[model samples]
Target: MSETIRLPHKPDAPLSYQFVPGQGPLSTTHLIVYLNGLIAPQSGWRATIDHLRRRWDEGGSRSANHPALLTYDRYGQGGSARDPADDQHGGSHDIREVVADLHVLAQEIRRTKMIKDADASNEDDGAAAADQVPKPKLIFVANSIGCVIGRFYAQTYPGSTAALLFLDSNIANSDQVSLFPDPDAPGFDPHVLLPPDSTVADLRRTRAGYAAHFHPSAPNPEHLDRRNIISLLPLSDGPPLRGAEPDEGTGPRITVVGHDWATFAEEGLRGSMNVPEGLTNRYVNPPWAAYNEGLARLTSADRARGPVIATGCGHFIQKDDPALVAELTDDLLRNIEADSAA
Candidate 1:
C-alpha cells in the first residue's frame, strides 16, 4: 500500500501515501487520515488501520460504511521527497508549511478520486467512482507531533476537518527538557525525588537525550513554536479558536487519548534514555496530563471530557494496543455521523 505513486503534485516535493477507497454511499464516506509521530513512518499505523478496517466490515461487505483510509510520509520522512526550501530555511520546515502540504495532498486525493467507490465500475476507474459520489470529509486520527500538524491543518482549511482523534499529543510550546528537574539550577535538590539507583549522572544523561532529540528547531522535524498555536487555540472557555467556520457545527469534534503512566515511564522515557522512573512520575506526568487536557478542550464539544487514558500503552499507543485505538476511532466516527444526522 505504501508506494511513490507519483500523484500529480509539486514535482520538486511530491509526498508519498497509502490510500484505500471505501465502499457504500461515498457521500457519507469520510477520509480517515493517519498522521504518524514526528519521526515515525506511516507504516507505524498498520495495526490500527487493519483493526479499524475489520470493524468497518462488521455490518456487511458491499455496503460497508468504512471511511477511506490514508497514511502518508511527510517531506524528508520515509519515502516522501524533501522540501527544497529547507536548506534556505536552516534545514527545517515551518509547521505552517508542513500543514500546507497536507492541504494540497488532501485536495489532490479528492481531485484525483483517491477516495471513492471502487466497485462502481469493472475497470475500477477512479473518475467514474468520483462521478458517483461526493468527496469525503476529513477525519484526522493523529499521534504525537502529528496532532500538532492536524490542529494547524484544521485551522488553515476552515470547515474541512469533520472530527479529530489526537493520540498522545506532544507537549507543544515546551523545551521538553525544561519540564524535568535539573541538577544544576537554583535550589536544585537531587535527593528529593531520585529513584534508588538513579544519580546526578543519570539525570544529566536524560537531559542530554531530551536535548539531542527534542530541542526547539534543531532536532524538531517541523519549526513549531508550539506555544503560539496553543495560545491561538486555547480551549473553548473563550470564543471559537481563530479560524473556526461557524457553519461547521461546533468545529471538529475532538477526542484526546494518552499513554498510561507506568508504561510511559518504562517505555517512553526509560527505554529511550537514562531517565529515572521517579522523575518521570513526578515531573513529566503532571505536565503531560495538563497538555492533553488542554488539547481536549480545544473544541466546545469535548471540553468537559478529559483525555482517554490508554491504560496498557506507552507513548506509541497504536503500536502498544491497536485494538483500543481502533475502537476509539470507530466510536468517534459514529458520533460524528450521529451529529451530522441530528
Candidate 2:
C-alpha cells in the first residue's frame, strides 16, 4: 500500500511512498528500499519491482517471509510535493537534504514496523512477547544519481544498513568537464549525446526540466565542478559497521554494477557527432572504470564483491536487464543470510 507521510519539520508537505510487506516472520524481515535517479519518479521502477516481487513469491516459504520492498518519489518529482520554503537548500535538489529525507524515511519505516510487530505479538502471544521481535535488516537498491544518496546514507547510518546495491551509478569525479569536448566549442556539436530519434524540441524540454528542479546556484549537469559532487563520493574513512565481525564473514556488503563503456560507445557513436573516438576510448573509459573500482575499494577493503560491468546494458542497467538486477539482488540477500548464519 502507498501513503503520504508529512515530514515532522515540514507539516505542509508530505512525501509519497509505497510499502510492500513481506510474508515472513517479523524477526527476519528484510527491508529493500529503492532510490531513483535524479528527476526520475518512483513509477519508473514499476517493471523492476514487478520482476522482483515475482522472484520473491517464487522463493516459497523461506523467501516469502522476508524482504519487503519500499520506493518513494523525491520532492518535486512525481507525486511528492516540492520542498517547503524553510528548506535549507531553498527548494533546490541538494544531496545533503536528500540524505536527510532518506534518514527520516528509514526511521519511520522502522517505527511503523515496530508498532505493527508489537500489535501482532500482543494479539497472539500476550504483551510480554512484543519485546522479542528483531529489527528488520535494511538493504538499499539505488540507481544513477540515487547512488549518491545511498552511499551517504550508508556511511551516516551503517549500523542500520545491511547492504547496498548500486546500479549504473554515477561517479562524482567522473563528471570532469575537461574530459569531454566543450559543447560550445566550434565544431563540437552539442547533440553528440542525444539519441538519433531525438529532436531539438525534446532537448529543449529536457533542459527546461533540469533547470526547474536542480539548484540554480550550482553548475548545470554538463558543467558540474568536482566540488559540487564531492559529497557523492564514498567516505574514505569507511562506514561504521557496529556489530559486524570480519571473522564471522559478516559485514555490510557493497555491490557496484556499471555499464560497459565500450558497448555504450559502440551504440552511442554515430554520424557527425564530432566527438573524438580516442577521447572516449582513452580518457573517458579508463577513468570511468577506475571510479567504479575505486568505489568498490572504498566500500570494502577485502573487496567481497568487485565492481561488475554489465556487458549488454547501457547507463540504465535495471531497465536494460531487469532479470539481471533481480538475480543480483537475490544473490545479495542469500549472501547476507549465509553471513548471518555463519
- How far is 116's C-alpha from truth in model 1 (Å)? 6.2
Global lDDT scores for all candidate models? 0.71, 0.63
What are the clashing pairs of model 2?
24-65
Best by TM-score: 1
lDDT of 1 at 199: 84
TM-score of 1: 0.85
Give the number of the best model, judged by lDDT.
Answer: 1
Model 2 Cα shift for residue 302 (angstroms): 5.3
What is the per-residue lDDT of model 1 for residues 170-243, given as tens digits with 9 covering 90 to 100?
Answer: 77657678887788888887777566657888888888887878755345443333434445545423334332
Question: Candidate 1, after superposition: displacement of residue 172 in Å?
Answer: 0.8
Q: What is the TM-score of each candidate against the true structure?
A: 0.85, 0.76
